[model samples]
Target: MPNAIQDQEIAMLRSELEMLMKEREALLRVAGYAAGFIAELDSFDVPRGAMQAAELLAECVNGLTEETLQDALSAVQAHSVA
Candidate 1:
């Protein structure tokens, strides 16, 4: 029946929406990382090696998922504090 088809379509749409939300969250996290790095670097005289390391870190982050980004950020925070 049409109601059954409508229900199925709604379910599919809900799944797609969930996927989009996850992708959005990942992008936001990446953006936040980029912003924070830019801000932190702007106020200091970063060495050439440090800048290169930051570039490498950014390259690695680009391929990571949201959960991985969270882990990486936590590691960076801990390293900075030490």
Candidate 2:
């Protein structure tokens, strides 16, 4: 009975891990697109009122690790073609 309970717990944990992974991928895709869009924005064109918000977004994206940023950018590029 104890072994069975442990097995059930492990299964639940695995399921949760899988769900988290999928959610991470979705988040990475969004981050990638946002980074790309921000890159194309001209500072002059951004409204003064929105400058702070835009800076915050850029700062958040820049805060990602290089590997994570690469993964995020790749995620969007991969789906863009289809």
Candidate 3:
């Protein structure tokens, strides 16, 4: 009985992990689209400072680790003074 319960719990965990992986993949696809859009915008003859900022933002998105992403979000929130 105990072995059967353990097996059931393991199966549930595997399903949850698979779902999380699929969600992560979808998020990555969205991030790729956003990066592509930013690159396209950068190709336009914008001001140097603006271009640089866009590139920096793109880098942040492309190389997003959890800690860095959180930091970036916090920084943006902090500067959102309306």
Candidate 4:
């Protein structure tokens, strides 16, 4: 019957749509990771001492506590050392 055929067609379309949605989600995740990697690559060129100083200033202006500043400085130092 025509109705049976139409129902089958709708079901197939729904399946394909679901597949497309999943693929899109995967693509977005990969894009996000790639962007972060690119940002790290860009950060690599910055001088360590300058980066630490800039980070300290930002933390001060942003009203971060001394402890938070120290933590951030440690992370920057670790990255620079690596």
lDDT of 1 by residue, 3-74 (tens): 999999999999999999877666656655664675577425877768877777666657677776666566
- Candidate 4 per-residue lDDT, tens place, 17-81, comes to 99998775554444344333444544567688777755554444346455544554554455457
Candidate 2 stretches with Cα past 4 Å from truth are none
Residue pairs in clash, model 2:
none
Two-way lDDT contest, 1 vs 3, winner: 1
Q: Which regions of candidate 4 are displaced past 4 Å?
A: 42-82
The worst-scoring run of ten residues by lDDT in candidate 2 lies at: 73-82
Which model is ahead, 1 or 3, in terms of TM-score? 3
C-alpha lDDT (0 to 100) for residue 81 of candidate 1? 79
- Whose TM-score is greatest here? 2
lDDT of 3 by residue, 1-82 (tens): 9999999999999999999987765555555555556757835677877877777768868688876455544544444442
What TM-scores do the predictions have? 0.52, 0.92, 0.56, 0.51
lDDT score for residue 16 of model 1:
100
Q: Cα lDDT of all candidates, in order?
A: 0.69, 0.95, 0.68, 0.58
For every candidate structure, what is the RMSD over all alpha carbons to the true structure, in angstroms? Answer: 8.9, 1.1, 10.5, 12.7
